[model samples]
Target: MAERSIIIIGAGMAGLSAGCYARMNGYKTRIFELHNLPGGLCTSWKRKGYTIDGCIHWLTGSSWGTLYRVYEELGAVQGRQMVDHEVFVRVESDGKTFIVYNDIDRLEQHMKELAPGDAGVIGEFCNALRVLAGREMPSDKPIELMGLVDKLRATKALSVLKAMHKYGRVSIQQFAARFTDPFMREVFPEAMANMPDLSISGLMMALAYGHGRNAGYPVGGSLEFSKAIERRYLGLGGEIRYKARVERVLVENNSAVGVRLADGTEHRADVVVSAADGRTTIFDMLGGRYVDDSIRRYYDKWPVYEGFLQVSLGVAHDFSAEPQSLAFRLDDPVQVGDQSRHWMQMRHFCYDPTMAPEGKSVVIATYAFTNPEYWNKLYADQEKYRAEKQALADAVIDRLDKRFPGFREKVEVVDVATPVTFERYTGNWKGSYMGWMATPATEGTWMKRTLPGLANFYMAGQWVFMGGGVPGAILSGRHAMQVICKKDGKKFRTSTP
Candidate 1:
């Protein structure tokens, strides 16, 4: 093939990573983003002096683990200060509180204390953790003969392969089921319910081992992360075009030729990679000409996860009653059966004082999992949506009042983001925060890839390689680029500056 240019759609984490990888590998790369900025749902927003992080909770490791090595190579961690979370997270239920620590032994002890007579279950769980302790994850490098060989020779590769051989095909539920304690079963379901069965708790267990080594937060927030990746990409001679909405990936016979933007501007390239929505890329943009039955079924059948409602609050004073800090699950479990009221979580933030004015606190109140039908019916009524959002914010404040007692009075600023907000800003279908859920049925499947049958087209981000967090997207971007590099007979590289 002749010297080729690659065009990437969507400037989310995955797209940015793909761009970087492609540039590193000596391919001319350009990215088109519908939004002006990057980072998708993981990006931060500012409203009246409050900086709210929409989705970042706690990343697995800072710069100590295998994955952190990738970040270090991407130039995302050099000179970046991270604040390790002192307390992992707390779960409050039925008027009882369970504090989860970074130490595996301490976590096991807490579990045992919470549910007496469950020592056997705890030990078994620990054994399972040990089994997964040194496991490896599938690399972002393309999955081919050469890639496999390189991976085999890479550091920690044998341990990863061993773990994969041992536990890759099983579901998380199945792994949890190995222990027969009610508490164990309940805990696994609660923790892993949102996670796909195939997420490799073995990989997560290794992360757990590494988390205590160093679990730090970025001082600036997610935007800083996005900017760092973008900076590196630009430094490598890659181009990122904002407000560029790709309408279709132009194809000649069976190979991806180029892409046509929404404004009817066509740019020619040898290969086109879509880090955008699969449905948007294949069916809507490509006019459904290339889709096979398998791809059709994926878009038409698989359920997309629901969106979130986020309320960012800037308070007048610090709510530092709890020294260690923070809870994951809310005090009350969301009432799935009830539709009249919504479930919300209030996160206490004193992590970065810069997030708010001096002596003030920033609290993020978020609640998700609403019915699509209810939201769709109100599209024509803007005032109604605004009212509902206000009401939702009020409910969150009420919940915070229960938890923090005097939280309602100190509210300096309150800004709400709805599903509509996400759809409008990020162009994700149905405002889904994560793409397709990586359940047992769809784990490690192609739903993680770009919409199938679209020529020279691939996708990255939460949509690919089983949706999880920022790390999954970053890794997937590298994978997509690696796959493209293989097609073009190139080598993978990363920019350090």
Candidate 2:
């Protein structure tokens, strides 16, 4: 019999993972990517001898013996060096900073020292995470939406419901309200104030803090991480084609048979997995034929997470006094018009100086929540848009100048990337960096991988799954591959050979 063919759309982390897994499991696989390189938004760009990572803050499961082990089992970054951040992270605001320590005890102590009466709240948070650490999650495998209830029942029974009750029902905003300390409130406001409506469950919150136990970064940045996985995929005889935009998942008689590329290239496949932008995959490329009215409406109404305008700077001096990455905020608490005023996020390459030339450092200032219309108008008036971008970069530099006195003098190169740039690169609608927000209505109370009435078609990455960060995308890819592997009656190998 001929070998089963699997065609994966997009070469993002999710697509790469799905392709890697399918190839390892005896399925012939090919990946199509619009961009010349993979990794999508998790990619990095080089500007004037500085490497600027796009969306890397802190990745969970970088430490061994954590839920992230799934990545290692698949040989995602087996030999690569992972940097475990000693201090989890810190938010510097209004001359008062809150440090989240790697050690829970030390973090609790810091919280108590900062706010004495709020010890109970901090203690409860720790206890909740402790309980979650003990609970065993169901297999990472993806299955039919109809089979979720049965699978959960068989795996954890009432425990799953109990877990949801404890961590899934409440939003981060509701939980942050429990604190009486103003500084603690400002320090850890749960959801970013701008994202108040974004659905963040209690379990996810715990996992966020739980990451402090093992905060980390990949040595060569996000792109290197993607390259490592791609290397593994190709090592297993998997094929990847760049500039191949998939037009449709070829379906015959309610089963996916193959795909047709934009260049009129046709490739047959037994299964098709899409790791591209959810909106594009669901509505545009597939023509929304697989999704139901309810699902389609959810997509139309779902607000995508805010986009960003970033300034990648190569500084002549070092800003490595601090151990971990820092979040620098504005003096005035209220929101301001300039994207920089909304959130002045500064992440430096002090930990890894190799990102820049010797004696210099790479600093990225991201101003998130910018309107997409601003970029659209830029194309009409190039000079005016260029001036605006320079002004925004200057303002961010001014803000950093206050934080790091005379910081502007060292700036050798400043490259600005707006939402339009992200849209052009990743094909995300409105240049949304986080895909669609994983709200209750959109992601569903129970996460569903495959859309209704879709034969041999599946959705992965931030759109359909739990909408987690890097780990979520990788898991989504693996799960989509699992669906194919099971249908083929092959033994599902969890680890790479």
Q: Evaluated with TM-score, which candidate comes out highest?
A: 2
Cα lDDT of model 2 by residue, 1-497, tens digit: 78888888888888888888887788889999989998888888888788888865666666643346777755656775666655655776678777766555676788788888898988876555554443444546554522757575546635534554554555556666678988777657522433544544533443443544443677778888788788878888999999888887777886777888889978987778888888788777767777776577657776666566778888988777753456756774322224335446567877775588877888886655678876867757888778877877787778778778989898998988888889888887777777656554443443456777667777678776544477778878887777766766777776554
Pairs with backbone N, CA or C atoms under 3 Å apart (clashes), candidate 1 = 83-216, 83-217, 84-215, 136-160, 448-464
Global CA lDDT of candidate 2, please? 0.70
List where candidate 2 sits over 4 angstroms from the true fold: 65-67, 133-136, 143-165, 190-194, 198-212, 332-343, 438-444, 494-497
lDDT of each: 0.68, 0.70
Query: Model 2: how far is 191 from its true place, Å?
Result: 8.2
Worst 10 residues of 1 by lDDT: 334-343
Q: How far is candidate 2 from the true structure (C-alpha RMSD, Å)?
A: 3.3
Q: What is the lDDT of residue 131 in candidate 1?
A: 51
Off by over 4 Å in 1: 1-3, 145-215, 321-344, 444-454
